[model samples]
Target: MQTGKIGVTTENIFPVIKKFLYSDHEIFLRELVSNAVDASQKLKTLAITGDFRGEQGDLAVRIKIDEKEGTLTISDNGIGMDAEEIDKYINQIAFSGVSDFMEKYQDKAEAIIGHFGLGFYSAFMVAKKVDIITKSYKEGAKAVKWSCDGSPEFTLEETEKESRGSDIVLHIDDDCKEFLQKSKIEELLNKYCKFMAVPVILGKKQEWKDGKMQDTDEDNVINSVAPLWSKSPSEIKDEDYKSFYRTLFPMNDEPLFWIHLNVDYPFNLTGILYFPRVKNNIELQRNKIQLYCNQVFVTDQVEGIVPEFLTLLHGVIDSPDIPLNVSRSYLQSDANVKKISSYITKKVADRLNGIFKDNRKDYEEKWEDLKLFVNYGMLSENDFYDRAKDFSLFTDVDGRHFTFEEYKTLIKDNQTDKDGQLVYLYATDKEEQFSYIEAAKAKGYSVLLTDGQLDVPAVSMLEQKFEKSRFVRVDSDTIDRIIAKDNAPELDLNETQRDILSEAFQSQVPKLDKSEFMVDVQAMGVDAQPVIITQNEYMRRMKEMSRYQQGMAFYGQMPDTYTLVLNSDHALVKKILSEGEASTKETLKPILSEIKGLQARQTILQQEQGKKKPEEITQEEKDDLSNTEQNLSKQREEKKQVIAGYAKDNGTIHQLIDLALLQNGMLKGASLNEFIKRSVNLIK
Candidate 1:
């Protein structure tokens, strides 16, 4: 037997180890179990390499608990160290100064284990003392017993051990007696080693016997040893992938599709990425992708490890290249992490492109669910956009899907305006915009369904991407004006007639909160409605964009401005114009005569003033000119009031405005109720 001090420069090494080894003391179980698995795997590798001539029998790592003895043991049939090997690896902790180390690294406890070779010392987190009993597989090697009691000194002595393996016994401290429970140790094993490369046996399989659950003779292996992701893609079936997905995320719905990632050259990355049914809640499915190293689970918060957009996907991403012992902030800055992120983005894009090329119908069938993800990718990753250009599709209101190029070719002849800009018509709500959609369809033009939450920003992006292209909501203008390809129809009303009708229609329009409406006259065929309401493209887009973006909130807060287009060619509008003309003639004749006289006097006064300097004009002449202008304005307003008074009593004018309002989904609340009341009264 031999007892000696640990080879450390500072006597404060033990306190530092206890204080600065791990963040969550619960993580100690993972580190210790991981070490045991590594040792067991090393033994198997040695046997395969012919370094060990002995039998590599039953290499199951077992964890045992003894509550009464207040002890927890992790044993493994792997490379066991003799006394000299223990002194070299265990006694001498490199570059450790107890006092300074504690002060510098005390706050960064989780970073200490993988930084230095202190995997064995993590046992001290929950245990007051730790003992290791082992016999090496080497020929003629004697058994060794090593013991440490939370100090820089340890005892290494020759002892008897029949098995060629190592058993780590931790005497659970009073503060950490929870680990001495069998169920607690089993839970930790399931969490950290459920999919480890080697089998992990906890205890005998239990059965309900004699009114209690008792252990059977068979060993209860806790892990599957080989998870589904580690297998070749060719060997996996659809059901296999589905079953594995359920195992990974039991509460989530089945995924829409999956991508198997296996790459070797640049950096080793292997795992399965699942496209879950995001169902308009992209945020809910985020952080579902777990990161693993060598089949040991690392973390699911893989924001920096994966592309920002790819985090919306759900699954596992196992990469040994990702640094494990660093904080998330550090991992995000690592160059290797960025490479992994770019690679994952490339893989996801490739998979989507492949699906599109092989099965377009299937792809389109899944497009509604895929829209949010694709829009997110296009918004975030430029390279992803460059790759997705060919496969990305724009779906129209007729339920037809077209690529960007295909749609451009399809509509280049019909929807291009006289200004040489391609006009792309779109509708946000198919039901609400049904009339506008039909009007656009009547003109032999296509209307896209841009109703997704991201479509507001995406439409702006597409307009920039497509050359000489612009997006017009179907209700943005009259169908003729939406795609102004040929000659515009003429409105034959004289200036007097146009003003009278414009004011007549404008006076009766409904008043709505956050709403502004303008009156414009258009000459449409008699088949069209007498009145129609449409919004302006630029203003509507600005308002829509304001919902997702800041700095443009002023646009959102502004009133919705709609154009009340009165169809002059329609029979009802022609009748109203004739009535307005007759009713306003008597009121306007006197006003027009006075306005002409006032304009003539003002022109004469200006001529008189032009002949003299500022002081030359008499005060009486200036007063006469000002009085003439005021009387002329009063006569004009009276003429306008006369026309408005006629319109106020005209049921046809009010009904036409209400019909247009109802068609555009603008009639609501009190106005809608009043329209219904007037509609019922008119029928009676």
Candidate 2:
């Protein structure tokens, strides 16, 4: 027997492997199991090429545990090594056995997956002493044994062995006793090797035949030798895809559809992507797409592989081009990764367009669930938006769906404003904004139910994409303002009359927390509601967007401002004005006469001094003009004070304001209680 240190420039390789090689030490099992699968695959290749004139035999990689001996062994019945082979592949520290083997037989070994030449060394992370015993497939070969004990020193000698493949034995360290547990090993195997190409056996299969689980004669195979993604698309059925989806996500809802990605020319990528039921929340459904490298599981954080919106999808993406150990910085800079992202975006768009063109009625039926994903993609990726423009759908409150161009054609003549801008009216909440929706529909206009969480941001983007188009929330303003065909007929009241009625109605407006209202009088035809509450669409949308974006937090903190529009043409408003004026008319007649006398004097003085220069005006004339203006202002205030006082006690003014507040979903708590009580009293 002869022993010497590993062929390395530094003695620190073992220490680095133990403490710093991988972020999680549990990955050691994955590396060992993958190496075993690679070895078995190589033997199969040699058999197919007639290089070996013997049976391929059972290729299942077996894992065994000896708790009393404190050792775990992974054995494979594949290509083994002789003494010279061990010295060249195992004794040399940095050289990879699989790398040179692939170089020799590149065409026959495509599934072999070993990179960086460091996977075998990772066993040092959890083992104190590791052993390798193997015998070559050649006609006359002797089995060899190699052993190392957590250091550069190793020993190689001839050993008697009956098998033809390799056996790797690991002596568990005291610090990593948790790995010895059966359940822990099973979990790691399920997560990383669930889809491996070769059969992986852990122990004897168990059955609960006699009220308790007992080991049977059969081996417990733990992996799927042929996953759906590795098969041809022509061999897969819709039910097969759905079954695979169910396997990946056991608790998730059934997927709406799936896209099978199979490409070889541009950096081989093959996988299945499913369009899950992604609605209501975008953040909750991310990180569900598991990324793999040559069938070995890598990670679930695939934001770099697919676009941000496509991360909302679910299923597997296997590509040999992706480096096994991925870094965020590398993913951002890798050329192959960028091409994969672009390709995924195009595939998603093409699939959606195909579905839309093939069966539009079916697509429309599923739009309620599909809109969120499509809208998010269109709002984020520029290329996706360019492709999705033709197929993206719009469903109105009437439950009829239309494409962007189709909707434009449907409402172009009636919904266009005087400035030739097409008005796309939408409502965020059908129940809360029902009156607003009905009001629009009453005017022969259509309203879209833009109630999705991402709909607000998407509408902001559509404003720039659609030609001469703007999306307005149905409840943001009155129908006249949303799609104004002509300037509304002006209110027929004078300035003082307008202010008096405005103040009267404004005084009855409830004080809601985080809300402020400004009163405006408009002549909105006799059939319109007496009082309507409308928020500015621009400010409202800005505040909504600030909920998702970072730099616009100031808009979220600002109080919601609404316009309290009082219709002058309505009888309730006209009656309030006339009655308030009538009740105060007797008291204001003499005040008004004195104000008129002062105004007449001021007009006479102004005419007399019309041609005079500033210095020519006497002090008495200036004092008289000033006193007349002051007295007139005082009299109008006294008159308005009386009228506003009467308006406060009037039930009609309070009722109108409360009804408007209730319609806008702003009336609640004590304010709502008070309105209810007041409403009851007025009916009594």
Candidate 3:
């Protein structure tokens, strides 16, 4: 036996390895297993290059747990290290054997994973002591044993061994005894080694024997030596891709489509990205894309590696060019990662475009599931938007689908306003906004169904992308105003009539929470509804954007402002105006006459004051002018009270206002019940 201190600059390297080597101690299993696989791969390369004439038998890496002994052993049938190699590789903490092997066999070695030699030290994270028994494949080579107890001091000795390989035995620490559990080891192997280059055996296959579960003699391999992404796309069938997807995510529904990424030049990359069925909540769909480096699993949280929008996709992305630290736990940003992101964005757009151009009907069938992803990419990535706009679809309320350009052409003739700005009318809810959608259709204008999770931001982006264009929700205003092609007709009403109508409707508007209504009388045709509720487009968009944007919280807190438009051409509005004048004209005449006299006196006093300088105006003249204004205000208040009284007793006014509220889906609780009762009475 030979004892020596590990050649390290720092004396406390073991403690750092045990405590701070990895973010998660569970990563120790991945590091050890990956090293074993690398050893196996090195041996294969040596044999292929005629360096080793020995027969290469089964190179499966095996993991075993001995709960009774409190030890976990990872054994491999690969090239093992003699005493000199162990002392050179193991004693020197940062010198990697794989790095030296790659330097010699760089052209022939397959998937050499170890870059930093620190992977072996990760074993100290969970093990109080570790032992390695290895024998070189060289003829007449002696087997060796190396032992370290979580310290720089280690023992190396010649030991008897049966075959050429390495057995890493870890005596788990007291606080880390969970690593001794069979289930825990199996879980780690499945997560980090499920797609490894070499076979990984966890335990024996289990079967029901004599009505009880028992381990069979067959080895239970946990990893696939050849995954779908590692293969050529032309050789794979559709079902094979789907089967791989099921292997990746068993509980998820079948993917809508997949993009096979196999780029070699500039930087090495290979993987399959599947377009998963995204639901209404975009957050739930994130972090599904698993990232790997040369078949070794890295992480699923690939936020920085992929673009923010591409995280919605699911499946695997394996790239040796992706930089990782020693632990291989997280990603490190570099030019390659950025290139990979741009490449993926382009691939996704190209896949979508191909699908749309080849089989548009099938693409349309999947649009409902694909909209959230496409819209997210369009809104977040400018380059992606430039590629995606040609294939991205706009589905209408009538269930017809059109590409962005196609929809623009379909509506360009009629939806353009008098100012030559193209208006894209959209409805959030097909049923809730059915009346507005129908009204838009009646005007021969197409209304898109922009109701996806990211549609609000996507529509905002489209407004900037399309020149001289704007997107307006169909229910945001009256159809004629939303896509006005001609000037609005003038209302034939005097100032008194306009004031009475405005006051009556405004008073009857319900006091809804977080809602404010402004009354406006418009000369819509007689076929229009008596009253329609319309939200302000800019304010409504700001509020919707606040749900996704961080700095727009102020807009979300403000009350929703809506316009309660009374159509003067409608018969109900006309009857209300005529009847109101007839019923209140007699009583309002004397009040109006008094108001007119006060206003005339107020105007004459204002004109007299305007003619004089501040020094020339007498205090009495100022007093008289102030008094006339007060009297005029009082007379107007009395007139408003009389009009409000008439409106309060008028069921038509209440019915019209309630109908507008119900149409907006805002009538709820007792108000909805009252609206229902009032509607029935009005019908009777």
**lDDT of all predictions, in order shown?**
0.82, 0.85, 0.90
User: Over the stretch 249-309, how does candidate 2's per-residue lDDT look in tens digits?
Assistant: 9999999888999998688899989988877777889989988777777778887789998
TM-score of 2: 0.92
Error of 1 at 88 (Å): 4.0
Per-residue CA lDDT of model 1 for 1-684, tens digit only, reads: 899988888888666766665555666777677767766766665665677789888787888888889898989887787887778767877422222233543543211223345667778889999999988888889999999988887899999998788899999999998898888888877766778877888889999999999999999998877888889999999999999999889998889899999997688789999998885787777888877777776677788888887898988877766776521112436788888888888888899999999999999999888888888889888888898888888999988999999999999998889999999999999999998898888778899998887887898988888889988899888898888756878889887888889989888887788899899998877887788888999998898888878799999888889999989999999999999889879878887788788878878877887888879889998898788778878877787788899999998898889888888777789888888989999899
> Which is better, 1 or 3, measured by TM-score?
3
Clashes of each: 0, 0, 0
Cα deviation of 649, candidate 2, in Å: 1.1
Q: Which of 2 and 3 is ahead in TM-score?
A: 3
Candidate 1: list runs displaced more than 4 Å.
1-25, 66-72, 91-116, 120-162, 169-188, 206-214, 326-332, 591-640
Winner on lDDT between 2 and 3 is 3
